[model samples]
Target: MYLIAIAWMYVVVMMTIAEAASPGGTLLGAFFTLVLYGLLPLSILLYILGTPARKRRIKARQAQEAPAEGHPPSGTSSGVAPDARSQPPAAAQTDSVSPVREES
Candidate 1:
């Protein structure tokens, strides 16, 4: 990758030099040509090339994490404590509340 970047830099430098030397081309035109034709396309190409590797790395990291997450601490089998685990769900407490009647 470094070699490719260095080679591209050399190509751009040579192009800019040639443009500047040409009777019809200005230094400003050379700068724009290097930015528009050279750097922009190279940047897009590098991004497209790197995307799959980036996604693979992310998936590999997630896969590594999944196993670690599967097993819990020895002290706690479930996320809740032993005492809390014995209790019924909070939603079951609705029996103790009186329902409100709507007034028209």
Candidate 2:
């Protein structure tokens, strides 16, 4: 892919040089030709084509940086105390007073 891009850029550079050297061609036109024809499209194409590689690199890096599966991350717990493991959840209280409604 890079080889193709390089070849394409070479062709565009030659075209730019020809445009610049032509009797009626302005240097500004040649510059625009190089940038518009060569740089912008090539950059966009490379970025689009390289997406899968970028994703793979990111995934590999994440896998490498991840902790082992056997151990949990630090600063986090299972939320249950060791001694409370045998206890059942407490029932809700039923002693609260009920709301009084107007006689209307």
Q: Compared with the true structure, what per-residue lDDT tens digits does model 1 show for residues 1-104?
A: 65786788789878988998999999899998789868997898789878999999997887788669885434544544455566645544356767999999
Model 1, stretches more than 4 Å misplaced? 1-5, 71-104
lDDT of 2 by residue, 1-104 (tens): 99999999999999999999999999999999999999999999999999999999997776666564533333324433334454423442246788999998
Superposed model 2: Cα runs more than 4 Å off: 68-104
Report the Cα lDDT for residue 50, model 1.
88
Which whole-number lDDT from 0 to 100 does residue 15 have in model 2?
A: 96
> Candidate 1, residue 88: CA error in Å?
27
**What is the alpha-carbon lDDT of model 2 when measured against the actual structure?**
0.81
Worst 10 residues of 1 by lDDT: 72-81
Candidate 2's displacement at residue 34, Å, is: 0.4
